[model samples]
Target chain A: MDISNLLKICIKALLNNKMRCFLTMLGIIIGVASVIAMLAIGNGSKQSIRAEIGSMGSNMIMISPGNGRFGGVRQSGSSMQTLKLSDYESIVRQASYIDKITPTVQSSGQAVKGAKNTPTSIYGVNEQYLDIRGYEIASGSCFTESDILHANKVCIVGQTVVNELFSDGTDPLGQTIRFGKIPMKIIGVLASKGYNSMGQDQDDLLIAPYTTVQKRVLAINYIQGITASALSEEYTDQAIDEITKILQTNHNIRIGQDNDFNVRSQQEMMETMSSVMDMLTVLLAAVAGISLIVGGIGIMNIMYVSVTERTREIGLRMSIGAKGRQILLQFLIESIIISVAGGLIGVVLGVAAAKIIALFGTPTAVSTFSIVLSFLVCVFTGVFFGWYPARKAAGLNPIDALRYE
Target chain B: MNEIIRLEQIKREFIVGEEVVRALRGVSFTITQGEFVTIMGTSGSGKSTLLNILGCLDVATSGEYYLDGVSVRQMSKNDRATLRNRKIGFIFQNYNLLPKTTSIENVELPLMYNRHVSHSERRERAIAALKEVGLGDRLTHRSNQLSGGQMQRVAIARALVNDPVIILADEATGNLDTRTSYEVLALFQRLHRDGRTILFVTHNPELASFSSRTITLRDGRITSDIRNDRIASAAEVLAAMPKEEEE
Candidate 1:
């Protein structure tokens, strides 16, 4: 018989035993739904961790000075500045994966604005520094490249510095402040970052053009460090590789020699944050897999009983001219219909359950991958578990089957 | 008359533990088209064995059997199943109507295995068969909702739906009361009058009077094969019964 007719026959048979079909399907429904719901919650936590890391600039790469052996002399860390303006310029010229790059130079001193003074560090940065460090300007604008080239004595003060310097509610924009001996013009106020996980206030710093800090405050032509960001989090490793290649080439380092700088991306910190989430994901998968197996076992058990119960029916069909293969198809299709229908209902229930969980604020995210994966798994489970019973139905002798009570 | 079935020295055996019980020793018979033949025997007379081989539900250990001019002796199991589907109809003692299934669907069961019968055609034939058996209005009724006589009519409709070459009835009326049995037997007699070949296997000796021919088996052997000059009308016998016991 044609497949459509066979399908109709199988469907009719299943409908004849609706209660049994439904009870058999319940196991699969629970399995698929639980798998989807658990995965949604697991994926949600993973996404949240990614977002938290993203907030700290996940792709941010910090190129800092490292130990280096120059021809005859070994200059370790602080004894020599390994990063240079030439190295930074070469990285900018050659790197393709980097989205943003900034040169940084640092100096700390007592900052004064009229009567108030605060011991704070002043950061030397350009226009790209805010984007690289995920910092925002509350008002006004950053110091331009023109300020860097001209060594303009312009700076942006953080919220804490603004509070310390102008406690009387006086706006600090366009006001002049002194860092050690250098007098700087405040052009912008940094947005408040509150305190970090380390309990350190992040808004107690000032930012100026790197050239201004290098030429006026420190009187140095070399850069202290370089900060950059990849085009996206996916390209962080490639971006680091590009930066390392350019820096090592500019430094004249041999193949076996250690580079004069270290490229540290926040990707490392993201890894440490993922361990607990990974454990939860694995636990969920294990529970879901075990339930699916149990559901498969339920299908197998029901199919065995169904074959036994329908023995006379099978014999009658065979007597009326049904091939053994046709009998097998009928039973197998019945099982597959049960499982696939259960899977469809489970998908709906799972998504609804995720939404319900989301309403409780656990942050469930149902992805298309989990749905497709669960669907394929259930179909496979049906076929795998339904095989033996269908074979048993197909292999029955018509004489015995017709005579079966 | 065209010969519809020809059997030559058919034999069947079963291995029960270490002992082999010979069910059919050597049985031979030929049935023509439009013949109503009753195979009569007591239990263990090999009547059921002969019926099974004739229905193609079981193969003989050593025999040459032909149905509708096709050799069934050496045919494969699948081929035999197809042959049975196209050439055989079966009516059982219990009616064997699929539970919770409508009468029309039960009638459609045989045609389901025939790929040439389309869905609409299948329905048309099932309705036609049910209507023929006086179950036209009960087409949608399930097995449990039907009376015993009505269920047998439905089974007869199922048997007639596929229009096979020969209809095989194994104690078709064994489970019914005398009135219902006569009602079913009358239906069979009408089918016989309509020129359909029939093989009725029954242990009841009185039931053999309704058929045109009777073959008696004893100890896996046919003891008598008689052609009855006068066939009894089951409908008349049913009508002559007491009217107060009809319900």
Candidate 2:
């Protein structure tokens, strides 16, 4: 028989019971839609994370004090304070790949500004800390090198500190805020930087000259950490290697001894974060794929029922000289049509769902690869699950089938 | 006349749950073209088995059967199907027309399996067959819309559409009333007069006089095969009977 005639017969048979056919296709629809929507949501979040990390300066590197050993007990890195100003000066003078470097010291305290007190973290660093960490000054000016030399009581405050310390319509620049009875004038207000991927508020901190916090507030000479930016992203690894060697030499650590500090780059962090996101996307897609298999089982079940219901019709066709393979092809074609049509509809629904999700403030991206993959999977489901039932229908004996009530 | 069908010692056995039921036991017959033959038997006489075997819908356990000089027992399953498509037309008892299908589409079903017939030619031949059966005006009517006699005419048109060597009908008029049965039998008689070989299987012995030959089966074996010198014409029988109201 020609394919057209076979298709016509199949369409007619399916059209005989419209409700049943639609119910059979519902499983496939849900399967494909979930697959597409899950992948889109996963991909959207991944892109946004990469963007957030990119904004934190791709070539930036950080160095912190390593844990110290005292009396056979390990002390935490924060309490060690092994990082020093001499080590930072040695890396700045010797490292060729490093373009910017700054010593860092941190202290947390309640800042009281005219009876409006707010608890916030205070970071201490040189003027280059803003450029290295991709922070911008929205208003006023950054403290000059003269201010660091004099251990100036000047600081830069982020948007969150501004909102907490200053009332509405009141200017924050040039205002003095007391940090544990040590008042520091705000020289600049940093621009807004929203929450990071880890849900940490980036704009809820303060920046001041490192020497001021080291000499006046903490009274210790050892620095807490150091931040630096390489000349370019490509030179970040080389810069870390050179700086590590310089620190090892300056700290008098011999060749066999472990260094007293840790060096980390933004590139390494990006690689780790992206790998975790990729694994998550695969996991979500896998869970959604289970629905596709379930949908295939639904198709197989309906096809079996359809064959049993149409036994007399099969006998009639066989009596009219329809070969066994022809009958198999007719039913197989019917299943394939149902699945493919369901897949097409599912693509539309999935994209719409993704768009609606994105509109509600969650990111979503629909990729063509997922669409094509889901469609191919749907076709495979139809063929794989449809084979057994079609074979059973083809193997029916014409005489017995005709006699079947 | 060419001998279209010949059966030699045809035997069909069914293994019904370890019990070998011999449905047809060594039956033999020969039928030629243009013959109106009837095979009659009660319920358990193996007449239905004989008709199934003759129509190529079943194979005898051990027999040598031929159609138009081709050995049927040696033919493969697919070859048998092809031969059935090209050489034998079947009319079932219940007017087995496909439900919800138009009359012309139902008649065109047999030709759909024949690769040599083009699409337009199949339609033309189906229309001609319906016209021959006096159903030309009812081509578009579905099977349920037609009367019992009209449905049988549509079935007859489908059986003739393939231009088969012979027509095998299994109790073709069994479902009709007396008047409707006579009308279908008259149509069969007209076809037989046109030189079409026809075989009608029925258990009603009263219908035997309508055919030119009668063969009776008893207990899986043929008890009698005889030619009737004076066959009753269905038209004459209808003329002599009183007219009935149209149902």
Candidate 3:
């Protein structure tokens, strides 16, 4: 028989038992919908994570003073002071992959202004620190080359620092706030950066020229670390390589000896985060896949029952010159129609569910691959689950089937 | 009359769990075209077995059975199904119309299995057959909505749609009341007058009086075959019977 004729017959039979057909399709519907939605949520979160990491100075590199230990003595990068201003200057002059550079020295202390005090860390950096570290100034201007040359006590404060040190909501620009007895004039107020992905408050810091912190606050000659931004994200690795070569040669550390400073880039962190997200997406999709499999089983189950229930119908068709293969094809076509129809509805519902989830502020991305996969899977499930029962119907003796009550 | 069926010692056996139950021991008969023949027998007299064999639903274990000059005894199941599709129509006792399906669709069923029939042609044939069975106005009525006699007419229309050489009906009137049964029998008589070959299987001896010929079976074998010199008209009998009580 031709497909369309067979299709009409099967459709008529399914419609004769509409409730049974719909219940059978429900399994595949839920299965496919969940699979699509799960994959979308997973992929969505993965992309958002990448965007979040990219927001945090995606091409920025940091040269710390040390790598935790040297000669069995615990030497932290924050306190080692192996990084120097000369090394930073050498990289700025020689490195071609990086477009911006900054020398940084941090000192933590309680800032006081008219008896209202709050503890905050002060980072000493050059004019390019704001651009390199993804910081934007809300008011006033950045510290200039002239300010660093004279070691000016001018600084930029974050929103949290402003909230803590200033009692009233008055303009703190050009006003001096003391960081442990050293009164520094506020040149600019850094824009608010609510929080990072790690749940760390980003708007809780102070910035000044490295020269001032080095000479006046810490009384130190060597700088703590160096931070810089590559010309673009793609040049991050090359920029790190250039910085390492410049630092290694400047420190006069031989090839066999470990360099006293460590060079790191945001690209490394991005790769690690991406791998974790990929794993999570796969996990969610797999969990949703289980539902699809269960749906297939449900289809198989109903097909068997339908075969049993329609034994007399099978006999009638057989008596009317329907061969075993025709009967099998008819039943098989019925199941496939059920699953394919359910699959179509599922794709629509899944996209809708994902969109609904997106409305709640959760990221969701529906890929064509997921929809296609769901379709193919539901079809396969129909065939896989539908075969045995159809065969059972085909193998029946026409006489016995007709004689069946 | 052209020969439509030729049986040569047809035998069928069944192994009922270590017991050999011979359903049709040695049945031999020949039927020509345009004959309204009834095979009458009691339950367990192998009448059902003979009907199944005639419809090509079951193959005989031994002996030869030719249907419309085609060798059917040794034919494979699929080949027999094809022969049944092309040369035979079946009307069951239950009517067996697919529930919730329109009468026209039910009549269109047998034609669906034949690849030679196109969609529009199938519909045309189904409508024509239904109208032939006096169900022209009930073409779109679902199977459940039709009465017992109407359902049997739909079944008869379905059987005739494929233009089969012979129609095989097994206890077709068993499910109906006297009035409905006579109405269906009258319809069959009209088809017989139109030269349609028909085989009616039933246990009712009274049904044999309406047909032009009668065959009696007992103990899985044919006991008697007789050609009626005087055929009782089902239309006259139905007209003379008391009218049905309308609800």
Model 1: per-residue Cα lDDT over A1-405, one tens digit each: 999989988899899889999988988998899999999999897887677677769889888898767687887665567788988888889999999998999988999987789999988888898998889999999988799999999999999999999999988999999999999999999999776533567799999999999999999888889999999989999999999888888889899987778888988767866787778987997798789789989999999999999999998888889999999999899889989998999889999999999999787889999999889988988898999999999999988898898
lDDT of 3 at B129: 99
- lDDT string, candidate 3, A1-405, tens digits: 788889888988899889989988998899899999999998888787777777778998988987646679987667686777888889989999988999899899988787788888899999998988789999999999999999999999999989987758889898899988899999999999777767677788889999999898899998988889999989998898888888889988888887788888888888888888889888888888898888889889999999989898899899888999999999898889999999999999999999999999899999999999999999998888889999999999988888788
- Measured against the native two-chain assembly using Cα atoms, what DockQ does each of the candidate structures obtain, in the order listed? 0.70, 0.57, 0.80
Ranking by DockQ: 3, 1, 2
lDDT of 3 by residue, B103-149 (tens): 99899888899999998999999999999999999999999999999
Interface RMSD of each: 0.8, 1.1, 0.7
In terms of TM-score, which candidate is strongest?
3
Q: What's model 1's lDDT at B128?
A: 98
Q: Once model 1 is optimally superposed onto the true structure by TM-score, how far is the C-alpha of residue A170 displaced, in angstroms?
A: 8.2
Specify the poorest-scoring 10-residue window by lDDT in model 3 chain B.
Answer: B238-247
Worst 10 residues of 2 chain A by lDDT: A66-75
Score every model by TM-score: 0.80, 0.88, 0.89
RMSD of 1: 5.8
